[model samples]
Structures are given as C-alpha cells and as structure tokens.
Target: MLQSYNFALSVVLLNVIGPSLSNCSVNMALGMWQKLQIFLAFVQSCSNPFDIVCPHKSHVQFRTQVHCNSTRPQYMCLYDENKKQYTEVCVEEAETQREGYNTILRGGIDGVPCSTNNYQPFSHSSNTGGSCAIVKTSCNDEGQLLYDDGSSTTDRSCRCDYRVGYDYVTVPSNKCFCKPAIEDCSCYMKYCDVNQVLTQDYKCARVYKLTGIFDCPEVSGLGSKDIEKNKKMPSNATKTGIFFVQIDYYQNKDKTYHGILDLILGIAIGMIIASVVLLSTADILNVVRLKYSHNDVIHIVCNHVETVVLCSIELKCHLESTRHCKFIYWTKRINGDISTITSRTPGIHGSTVTYPSLTLDSPLIEDCGEYVCCAVYDYGRVCSPPIRLTVTGDVPSFSVDNELHNTDIGKPVSLFCKIYANPPCSNVVWKKYEDGQYTTIHSDSIDCSQTKYFTFTLNLDTFMESDSGYYFCYATNIVGTSKSKCITLSERKYAPTIEVDVDDNYCFNKINEDVSMPYTVSANPPCTSVVWKKKGDGTSTTIYSEKIASSPSKHITRSFKLVNLKEKQSGEYFCVATNEVGTTKSQSVLLYVAEAEDDDFSSDENRSTVTTLPHRRTRYHSCPSNWETDYYPIKRRSRLLS
Candidate 1:
C-alpha cells in the first residue's frame, strides 16, 4: 500500500508542474520538481477534515529545511546497464530527513506564472526521477506575475540603438552615434537622430555597438539657413550631417579711427593747396631775387671724369617775373693754366663751369691735380673751389696748340712747351742733339701760377749740325718734368767762308824731298771739324774739330810746318775750308822741284863712268770742295837756246 501511494503521489506532482515548464529542451528534464510549491499551495487549499494525510507527505516541511541546509551537489546521473537500474537505495542515501518532509520522484511539466493565480512563491522540483531547478517571479499591479525560465540571469529591460553601415557610436555602452553614409558625422552631444534609421543587427566587426538610445536636438539653422553646412562629402560617404554648434557674437569701432582718417585727408588736401601756393609764390620770389639781388649764385655739376673734352658748364639765373639777364665775360683758372671760358670751348671738367648769368666751357687738366675755374661776372669775380681732378691714364691728354714747327737752320727756333700741372713749375729747359752729342740748354726759372697752361718757347740760336738734328722742349716743376718729342731741323747747306788761312809757307813752297805738311781750315756757322786726305791714296787724317769764330765771315787762320816731302807730296799743294754748315775747296797749286840733270859720260872702258843724280818724277793733286782758293796756277818756263 505504501509503494502504491508513493506512485500515486509522483503522478500527482508531475501533473502539477508539467504545464509551467519552458520550451527549452533542458527544462523538460525538470519534471515535477519545477512546480512543487504551486502544487503544495493547491493541496492546502483543497484539504478536508475527512481526507487521509500520508505520513511521508507530512515530512515535506522538515525535508525541505534539511535540503536547504546542505550544500547543493553539482552532479549528473545516468542508468548503469551493468547494475540494472542502480538501486533506489543510492537516491535515499543522498537525501536527508526533515520534519514533515514529503517528496516523490516523477516526470512532469513545470507550472507557468500565468496559470499559478499569483499565489505561487519561489520553488524547486518536487517529482521523483527529475532534477529540481529554482524559478523566481515578479508581479505587477494587475495581480499578474511574470516568471523567469530560471535558465538565464538577464532580463529584457535594456534596448540598443539601431544603425547600418559605417555608423558612428560611442564606446562601452555606445550611446552616441552618427548616421551612416554621412561625412563628419561624429557625435558632438548625444545620439544623432538620423543614425537610428539604420538596422542594428548589421554591425561592423571591431566597431562598438550602440546599446543605448540617445536623442539629438534639432539645429535650427542647419540646411535651413542661406549657407550650406558642408560642401563636399568623402569619396565613400554619401551625405553630410549638420551638427549643433555654439558661437559667441561680437562688434566694435571707435572715434580715434575716424579722427585719424580725417587727419590724413586734411593733410593731403593741405599739401595739395600748399603746393599750388608755393608754385605761384616761388615764381614771384625768383623774379624778385633775379632782379634785385646780385648774389644769385648757381651751382654747377660735372660728369664723365675721363674722355670728357669740351663740355659746357651751363649758366642759369632764376628769372623772376620782373627781371632778365644775359651771360657776361667769363674766365677759368685750372691747375695754374689761365684761360677765358667761352662757347668755343664749351666745357672742360665733363661739364660747363656754370654760374648765374654766366655759364662757360671748361679746360682739360691733362693730369691728376687740383684745379679751379674762376668765373668773372658783371657784378664781380667769383672763384670756384679747387676741384680735385683725378684723371685715369687710360686716356692720356695733350696740350693743344703748344708746339712750334717749320723752323729755319742757323736761326733760333722756339718751341712753345706747355703742360698742365697742379702746383706751378719754375725750371724749364731745352734738350737737343748736336754733332753726334747731346746738349741741354737751361732757361731761367719763372713763376707760373696765373696761367692754366704754363708754357715757354725755347730759344736755340748758335746752332750746329748736331744741334740741328732734333730739339726737345722740357718743363719741370716740383711734381715732375714733361718731355716733348724732338722737333727736327735739317742742317742748311751754305758756301763755306774761308775764315782761316794758316801754313802760308806750305801753300807757296817747292817740293824737293819727302815732306809731310800739316795745315788747318776754318769756316762758319762753326766747322764740325777739319780733315785731310792724300789725293791718290785713300789715306785721310783729322786736323781740326768743333772750332768756330766770333763772326760767320771773320778770318781765322791755322799754320802747318812740313819737315820732309816726297814726290807724292811735292806734286801739287792745296787747302780746303769747311764747316758743319758747308765746305769750300781752294784752287790746286803747282809745285816745281828741279830734277837732277844727267851727267856727261867720262873716258870709256878704262875708268867706270859715274852718274851725277837720281831721277825724280812729278805728280799733281787737286784740292777737295771743303776750302777757299789757297793756291796759284803754275806758269810754264821758256826753253833757253844753247
């Protein structure tokens, strides 16, 4: 009867919990244990005084207390075929006794919350051959209770934001988001609204899921204002979203800025007005100065230091409305060279020497030195400051019209030698070559300051053949000496005037023995020298040199004594006179020497005949063209009849 009662009890508990079980495959195994509390609650409500209460059932309360006190065992059991249905003993041993505890093993469906009429509390399984699981339920004001399947710890209370491709969302909870296919859609505040339209299940890998719902506020001016929020979208993106932005407003200006602008305009206008006034006033003042003032000094500017020859230093005067003036006489002093500045020579120092009412040309300073050009005006003499002249030797300068040419011989020729030097020079000399020799003629040094081009003509009289060759004029000062190329003069040919007739005895003597005669001849302007040569042989000798007389025609004589003479010397004697200027030869003179007569022959053969004298031959030589007439012609003697 106890076994039959236990079987009936299992069947009843199974029936109570069967319907409450969830559809989960694991919950089916819960059987009657799933709804034990609900069944008990029903039992208490249905009990009558006349019904029989099982003794085992009365221990349900005590057994429940004991099960609660023991640590729940985590184990699984299966049928062991070798030991045919492992004994119920193992199950009884695992269980502990509790006062009024009653449990039966069975299979049954678990009771659900909706069917429990809200009377059920917390419960575990109460059926035999089934495992017990805990089920908890919560209730609402409608007296309805909702039960958890007891399989999971989570609830359906939370919701996530839904979005599609490339959605922007925050991390962790991932509450904020931006709409997909949009540019610059990063969340600035909360959730972006357009982002919610996308599907949530379609999320990207390595991307945070929007697990929270957030609302975005409406931006009033975005896409609504005249200006577009964005221009271009990224290549992969389709649209750009406008975001809420905060901005501060400002405006400013001041009175100082307006005042400055006014000041600038006033200054500009004043300047324009001042310019017009000054223009008219300056014209009138200039006229007044030109008419009333004599000290209207004008400045001059020079340009082109080298290669600048004749340049006009322009002269100008400011002509007031009342006055007019003309250029007067002008002069310039350049490095001691004096010259009148005129239009012929327009300018010298690259430009004209300019002055008020007096503009004049300038002179050239051939060398580097200090030069000044003094202008003489109608009022007075106004001198310019010493202008330093530094001329490059790249283009050398020459003093114009300062040389003399076309000179005559024997007469003095003066070469005007001038040069441009800074400080005045005193010493001047004339240098020349004369008779294969050099001669320097000195002149008295003279002061030269007032002249711009200091020059002196050299006087070279008493000239000789050597002196006639080439003449040079040199001028020197403290600075240096300047040399001019030689001015050539050919020696003039003139008849040699016989000024000397020495050796009169030699001129009129008869030649009888071997004799040597030595003589001299002199002439003017001055004889270079005297020479003698044998008529037949080319032998010649020098007799006199560089000898001269006071006057060109004065007679100066030289004497020659002969010791021995031969037939060659006895033939004819003549004298020649010559000078570097010219030469003249004297007429040939015939000299007679008695020849020894042939002696008569004495007796023949007995005594040797003796000759009385040796025979002598006579010869004659003519004088050359270097001397005057110094000999008489020979007169033939008449033969005596014997």
Candidate 2:
C-alpha cells in the first residue's frame, strides 16, 4: 500500500509540472540526489515566477549569462539546443532563490515579457534557442509617452514631445506620453512655452513687454479694437492657452500753432511710418554666415592650402524681395591691408556662385591673415565668420630618398634627394667624386614637389664598373645650406682590369742588374688570384701565383723580377688577375736582354720599348635626389713597384 501511494504521489507531481516542462532532451542517468533537487524545485523554473520550465519535457537545454544592465534584465529560460544551454542546476544555485538573476535580456523564446508574446524571429523548435539580449529602450525615455503597443524585438515608440508644448503624464498608465499643456496643466504646471514662464507662486505667467524696442507698431486695421490685453480680467483666464498681446495709444492736438505744428508733426509721423515700412519690407542679411573648415589656425610650409569663405542666404522667401545676392570675398593680410579677392553676383540661395574659397598656392608667411565672405544687400552688407590662415617657413634640410646605394654594373640608377624648405628652397648643389676627379653632378628637377618640398632627381642611363663612388647633396634656403650625408655605391661584382709597367731593359752585364715587370689589378671583389706568365713557344708558363684583393696593390703593385739579367732572359711576359666575375690579362711587354758591350748601337735598339693603355672614368653620387656624396674621380694610373 505504501508503494502504491508513492506511485500515486509521483503521478500527481508529474501532472502538476508536466505543462511547464521544456521539450529539451533530458540526461536520463542522473543521480538520485539530483532527482530529489528537481523534485524540490519543480515549480520554481528560472527566476521568473511565470516561467516554470522542465528541461526533460521541453527536450532543450538552457544556459544563463545574466547582467542586470541599464536594460533591466530578468532571468529567463531560452530553449535552443543549437546554442549553449544554461544548466538548470546553475540557475537554481544562483540568485534564483531570493535575490533573482542579475543578467541582461535573454535570447530565444522564454516566459519573459516580449519573448513568446510577440515571438517571430524563427519557428519554435527544441533545436533552436537563446534570448534576444539586445539592449531595448522603452518609450518612457526622456519622459516620452507611449502611443502604441510594441513587441519584445522592437522598442516602444514615444507619443508626444513635451518640449514642443506637451507635458508628461506621470501616472503609471500614461507613462509613455507627452501631452498638450492644457490637458496636463493641473498636474504638470512645469511645462511652459518660450513666451510663458512658470511662476513660483502660481501657474505659467505671461512675460511683460518692455518699452521702446519692445513696443509693437500699430496695425492699422486688424484687431485694433482691444489693441492690448485687458489687465482688468481675472488671472485664471490668462493661465489657459491665452497666446496674444495688446497695446494702446493716445494722441492730442493744440490749435495755438496749428499750421506750423501740424507741418512738423506730419513730417515726423510720415518719417516714422516710412521708416517702419522700409525696415519691415527690406531683407537683412542676418543669415550671411561664414564657414571656416578649421577651428584652429592653419599652418603651411610653402604649400598649397585653401580657406573657405562661403555666404548662405537662409531667407528663401525673402530672397525674391532682395535686389541681389552678391557676395564679396575679402582677406586681411599680415601687413594689415584688407584686400578683396573678388565679388560674385546673384548667387544661388543655398550655394555659392562659384567655388567659394581663397586658394593660396605656394604662399609665403606674408600672406598669412584673415579671410571672410560677405553678402551685399541693398541697404547693408553682412560678412561671414572670419577664417585665420597662416604660412610658415623653416630652413632647408635634405634627406636620402634611397635606402640602399648598391648597384649592378650596366643597370640604370635613379637617385632622389628630398628636403622640406618651408619657404621655397633657393638652390641645390650635387657633388661627386668619380673617375679620379671631384666634379659637380647635374640633377634634374622633379616638378612633383617643386612648389612644396624641394626635390631633385639624378638619373644615370647605366651604371658601369667604374661608377662606384661617394656623392653629396647641398640644399640652400633663406636660413642657410644644409649639411649632407655621403652615399656610396658598392659594386656587387666586376671583372678585373689589369695594367703592367715595364722598365727599359738592356742585357746588363753587372752582376746585380735585374729587370722588373710590375702589375696593377682593379676589380670590385679585388681579384683574389693573380698569376705572372711568360709567353713561350705559343704557350705560357706561370712564374708567380698568389691571392690578392681590393687592389691592395693600389699604392704598390706586385712585380715579377728577373735578377742577374742575361741575354737568355729575353722573352714576352705578362700578368693575369682574376675574381669571381672574370679574369683580365695585362699588356704583354717584350723583355730585351743584351751584352753591355753591344750598347754601341742606337738608343732605340738598345732600349726595350714600353707600351701604355688608356681607359675612361666613371661617376657615382647619392643624395636627397640621391645626390649626396663627394665623388672625386679616381685616376686609374698604374705605378711601378720596387
């Protein structure tokens, strides 16, 4: 009987919570303790009392990440299997007990306010879930009143604007509405129009009109009976939407000097009436506003900058009443002279007749000042806001335009030199040390920055093995010339050029006499291997061999010596230099050996003839235009070694 009773109890409890259960697939293998907890908290589904969800029944999962932000979050059970599900145990463990969940709005359908009531994001399914946590605003924002119903995904639209003569309904029912002042006056006495003011002692009171400037000119016929409000009336009538003012006037005449007084009075009255009519009908350019693009002072360095000076006539209806919509652009220079750039006539109501700006191309600091646009009407003229323009100047300083000055032989080289000379740069000089001489390099003007930054371009048709040297750039401005840095072009690889010097030889019978054949090698990698050879029987025999570099033999050439000379020493001899690129052989010189007694012959016969070879020079420079360096030409003269 007790088992039967427990079965009955379980059935009854399931029936009670069945409807509230979600379709979420339940994890069946739960411990008995968890089952007990579920039984205990069966009716308290998320923090919301209206939501009694059973995960097993819904066949979906839920995860709650709640932050009670400005949107006022309420705990909800969103049913979407695809989304991460908040476990029921976590919800129960959190503030759901008493304090409630401190979370943002949820996604997917739950028992929340707009969740299921106006759900339309997608069809409801166990696989789909999550809550719309997007921040939502109620119509009650800014004291606005709600006029129509809204859904959970949409915001409640406000009803009326209190600033435009409506007051808010403070009651809970009318929380979303701003209503007419008359209907809300009793409870909302604070709302008042600009013409009315709220009094500390009572409702809104009419502001009194002062004299002179405040005096209204009489309209000859319209509502002239009671020109001014009757102060005799009770205050209550004025409190309710009374929006008009009244005025009164009195006149008296004396016949003592009737004729003369009448003349003077008639003239004064005519003048006053005429002035009033003219002032009322005439169009004043109060709308002529100046438009300056920048709020701060403009600074320029020999650069092009334009200042905007626009005039806009906002009176569309009054435009037809004006004679012309002429505008004049004027400038106040640093010299204190106010010069007019030009004038435009009959400009369109909303736009300038032409581009309305003062373009100062390559201007000096002397051109710095103020600029303004003015609208000229028949009676008067009005100017727009003034704009401040400035031109700045500084000394010239050049910088390298190329990062690296390495080049391959026979390839074209383009070196660029650039400098910022606030006030135009006066001159630029390029110096190069190439081909054994210090010569000037001519640079072409790169017009791109000619009006702004000083830029020079030096272009070489082709780079040669000899075109490796230092270059320098000099730029001059008002202040002075700028110091330059050197740019050196290093040749990656080059074949060696070899030259040999010969000494006049005659077979000297002296025991210590020797004939020397000295050689020089010029190669980028500095020929590493050099061999001295003597041509014999259509073939050559190597006499000397060694590793040499960087023309180390520049100041001193290595030579093959033939000491203890004899007639048998006569032969054709030469030296060869080799690097990674290629090899070069020096000019072969004939070594003549003779007997000392045989000197009786002619000097030509007695002397061994010497031969010389001529070669061209090369140039290399680096700078802002890539024109930087002291490129002094290096003469390729081979010196004989001891």
Q: What is the lDDT, from 0 to 100, of the residue 1 in candidate 1?
A: 23
Per-residue accuracy of model 2 over 537-578 as CA lDDT, tens digit each: 979976567765445432235555655555554667777888
Per-model C-alpha lDDT, please? 0.35, 0.41
| Error of model 2, residue 275, in angstroms | 43
Q: Tens digit of lDDT per residue, candidate 1, span 1-642?
A: 212222333333233222222334214333322343234334334533222221133444454454433353322132233453321212222432121222332231222221111122224333222222211122111111122222222221111222212223333232232211122222211232321222233232111132222243211110111111122212111110111111111111445643564465456435533543343454445546554564534333442233223233333322222123232233333444433433344332222223223433432435334333333233222343343444322121125353335433456755565666544445556677777866887765666644446666666665544544666766554445676666665544455554323233223222333223434444435555443322434543322233334445423554332323333334444556666556776544344333333243234342223433346232222112233333211211111000
What's the TM-score of every candidate structure? 0.22, 0.30
Off by over 4 Å in 2: 1-155, 159-450, 453-495, 503-513, 520-527, 537-539, 549-555, 565-570, 579-581, 592-642
